[model samples]
Target: MTANWTTYRELLLPGLTGRRAVESELRRAVRDGRLRPGTRLPSSRDLADQLGVARGTVTSAYTQLIGEGYLVAKRGSGTTVTAACSWPDTFERAPDPAQRWRFDLRPGLPALNAFPRDEWLQAQKVALLALSTDELGYPDPAGFPLLRAELADYLGRVRAVATRPSEVVVVNGAAEGISLMGRVLKAAGHTSVAVEEPSHFGAADMLTSHGLEVRPIPVDDKGIKVDVLSTTDCRAVLVTAAHQFPLGVVLHPERRHALLDWARAHDGVVIEDDYDAEHRYDRPAMGAMQALDPSRVIYQGSASKVLAPALRLGWLVLPPDLRDTIVERKRLDDLGTGTLHQAAFAQLLKTGGYDRHLRRTRQLYRARRDALLDELSRVLPDWTPIGVAAGLHVVVRLPAGVDDLAVQERLARRGVNAPALANYCRLPTFPGLVLGYAALTPDRLRHAVHELLEAL
Candidate 1:
């Protein structure tokens, strides 16, 4: 997840007081290795304003740190923690998780390098200027009306999600959306919820946390087994119908109808996690299952896959009857997502900037995916790539008798981090690795695949 500069500011600002205090904090941070080498200090003027100190005080602290060999400042480059600062041996410090790998092919990460910073900043500027004083106040716990409206319309057009502004309740991200669903469903007499057998482990943990038994229903090439689901007593099921996670399959059209029929017959609900609603390569991705039965499907969408996850933006298009309860749950959850972000995203949506971003990233991701597939065929001809060519990742089936877990370990030793497919499953499944291609260039992806070949 990406933290905005403002988030970093909030995290670093509290309890900072005088020049000495600032110096003390910086020294402690650097000494403990929390402030790792090469970390740039905030500008002196910005630090002064944020901390209510004189600009010269910040400059003094910088000078003191520099003189002591803790920091270095060049003419063009800002002040940075110097290599002279000792890496704390006694402290349990670590680098960013991705830094551990030479190539990060783990599933579900978007291309952070390709994030549209300029366009987002422009949207934020528009939002900030347009927001009325009243709009800046505590928002309706459900969401900002403008954002809800924008999300409703955007989802309708892009994913064919059936919704209205009143039905959309903005949450922090899909994680929170799932948590809210778990809480609400469990409270409303739902004892168990069915999830795809090979599904997001974090979501299962969330459901378990809320006292709901998460049943792992088997998924086939056609998607989740609705026939099997019909026999179960679970009243709600979470699905990635648009582009099934990890596997990247779309829910088959007949099965889609059958699942909704099951919902109608059994008084069940579907939590449609449209995690990768767009980003399809070969063709237009299927519309969300939420469109088939709005009363039964709770649609979940987020910017995590399209934008940087650090943005922490997601929404739920709720059933009319469930809207009030979910919105009330959101009220108690965090009063609502931050208004500034919501407003900025609204501006992005309203101005068509979001669509432009999608168009650009779709092409980039498609090219990267092509490079990976082509390399796999050339170098590892025996490996089978499964599912549609429509997501950030592709699952490659290993030759029979190969242990994917062992392969993953070997890849880890080689500084690559492709996840074993079996780890995502509750039941036994085929041996394979889930490779994410979005974050890496075509050349890097090819290099990673060669490394995989070596590991094999």
Candidate 2:
């Protein structure tokens, strides 16, 4: 299909003043199938004359289009649309009407809609302007020095984590921190690590993938059974001491002492995931277990729950002995996390912006949590909510003979999303739903609870 000069020249009549504008018109024509494959175009000189534009503009457009595979120009051959150019008929896949939900109650998410964008942008601007030329070069693998120093001070003040700036290593997120720790432990001749039963399954999978046998230790209202962990042949244990995932119970004070004692007795290690300690509502914030025995415990904390998950910013306060190996592992993993983000976060901490944001979000999340509980009580009083003292989620225990997975599926069909508690466990123990209320407003949560009841 050879396009004559008159037919194609008319297509380029509008908005053909600049080289880029000419290129855009031609590109659009080719993409929309007006200039079909194998259609020869007019000479650049002829097109420029016809469109009343400079010849160089047409030539530049031709060169760009040729480079983009939209046009082919060869020596001793005229310019033509590429024979291979094909635009497929594209359509968006329609969503399943039955599966479209009005609310999402799945766990481990922050209220992203409430993120402090202006504060973060201002912080970034300040950090960049304040950065010295030497500071912008290849970043220190451990972390940005300012960020490490600020985080050291902040963690000590807020979580009672005892560590110096030299002891902290910034990584991508909590997941990468766990992976790095697993590799470090594996290299140290450790074969097995114990994890809380019905915990975040991703932790277990990461340990197994790193060639460590994962032994599950059951968790009750008091958190992981330290007695059972003592009996295991594992040399390391991963725990969410502040706020247990999916279950939400704090590690009891007695269990905390027993865990440290067991670690001391066997020369073992404890990996503490202090994921959402800052979101506590009902009581004083619990200090991290790492404060008790920094030599035997590795403390990991992330900004995912407080700030935004997209930040992928987390830090590890390592025991002095394990510091070198973990830093080496991080250096080999990704060199280091983004330097600019670390600097900005450090600014947020130093200027008290981060703390202010935390104070605001804590209150907002507490209100949402209360609303969710109230709605659940009014709609389904038989279902009991557990672990409401801290964190963004609560587990609602279903009545006898009710299947949690079945309820989850039913909720999905009725436009509500709630994950079954069994999904997080290696072995089934109870039927329940893990509901997160932080991401949605109170009205949306109320409507979702009503829908969930209808599904039930």
Candidate 3:
């Protein structure tokens, strides 16, 4: 079957077109079923050579087809036909046929390649050298005293959260924070939690897994609607106030006030997930919502976005009353986050190394994001990349009736790793793909954009 491509091409030569010839050939291939859905196309160099055309011409042809939803590309894999239109509906079902893509653009991740391995190792070595014998024994259930103090100071300065050593509970990461909070909140007689529509599905799912009724609150360009929130009888609302996941809209000052007011009036608590607030590329960064009303907001921040997710380091600033309950839950759960890593992180913070690392990565990510936007502009004229101000991803909204999920499945079959935005939403809405750019190089980005357009 693979050899048939060249064997058939010899009998039917494909003419080269400096302009519209490529587009015409693409249309012909799709019509004739020569390039069926989920069919992996050859690389630009290979295709260009096979068709006896320049590589730029191949790129142009693929770009045109991608816009029209004919092909797709993924990281580490070349192009392929969109499986939705060409194969069975289950074509390109996610988390399957692993290694199908050549490029991955899914959101909510930092570039693991850029982790500060040397600096972290140095900090760990220093901490270990200075450690007392007693430090290695059974750790404090709350957290390492040094890490808690460091987080207390750091959150105070950057996030303006009313954090203190005693009130800060360290978990393995934000996931644990959610679980701990859910456990405590459930124990306190809260059975329902209101979440943002199109919110972090992972978080919302976690809430549901804990047997709490999950209600969806609508989100506008500003942030989650505060008026609709008052209608619900929920005991808590989980919010990504600083940089809302997927959408990347910062909760405005007025909305923040509204949220705080709602929390105070309803005797409700706000679980703030400050997920990627540190990697701001737009205006000056905003502080945590807990700053406005500490008692009503349980502030959660993690090193996942800035450093890496594998660190499993996160802190929760709890109200004075719920502090003991959350800590006890943490103790019963994972015992506690490791002492040495906490100590090393503390040293990284105090010595100014972590801040410097963040500054460097922020600059690199900003450059990569610019490259992705620029490529989108050049390759995709009609399509606009939304939510470009901050975060690792940009949303490309296709015109109405585009079926972004279908287009995404098609792209995946073609070897591109872009996921549809519809996957995140619990309710039906617009069709778009979330394109993450932090981990890709400029050359890789250009190739991905070209392949994406071809797959579409």
* Clashes found in each candidate (C-alpha, N, C closer than 3 A): 1, 0, 22
Candidate 2 shows a clash count of 0
Q: Compose the digit string of candidate 1's lDDT tens values, residues 1-456.
A: 122334335545475666667877777778877777878777666667777766545665765566455766654566678765675546534455554567888788999878889989998998999999988888899988999999999999988988899999999999999999999999999999999989877798899889999899988899999988887899899899877877877889999999999889888899999888788999988888888889999999899999989999999999999999999988988888899999999999999888998999999999999999999999999999999988899999999998786676556546677878866777878898999999999999999989999887
Misplaced by over 4 Å in model 3 are 1-100
Compared with the true structure, model 3 gives a TM-score of 0.79
lDDT of each: 0.84, 0.84, 0.78
Give TM-scores for every candidate, taking all chains together and pairing residue i with residue i: 0.80, 0.78, 0.79
TM-score of 1: 0.80
Better of 1 and 2 by lDDT: 2
Stretches of model 2 off by over 4 angstroms after superposition: 1-100
Error of 3 at 93 (Å): 18
Q: Each candidate: RMSD to true structure?
A: 13.4, 17.0, 11.9
Which candidate would rank higher by TM-score, 1 or 2? 1
lDDT of 2: 0.84
Model 3: worst 10 consecutive residues (lDDT sum)? 89-98
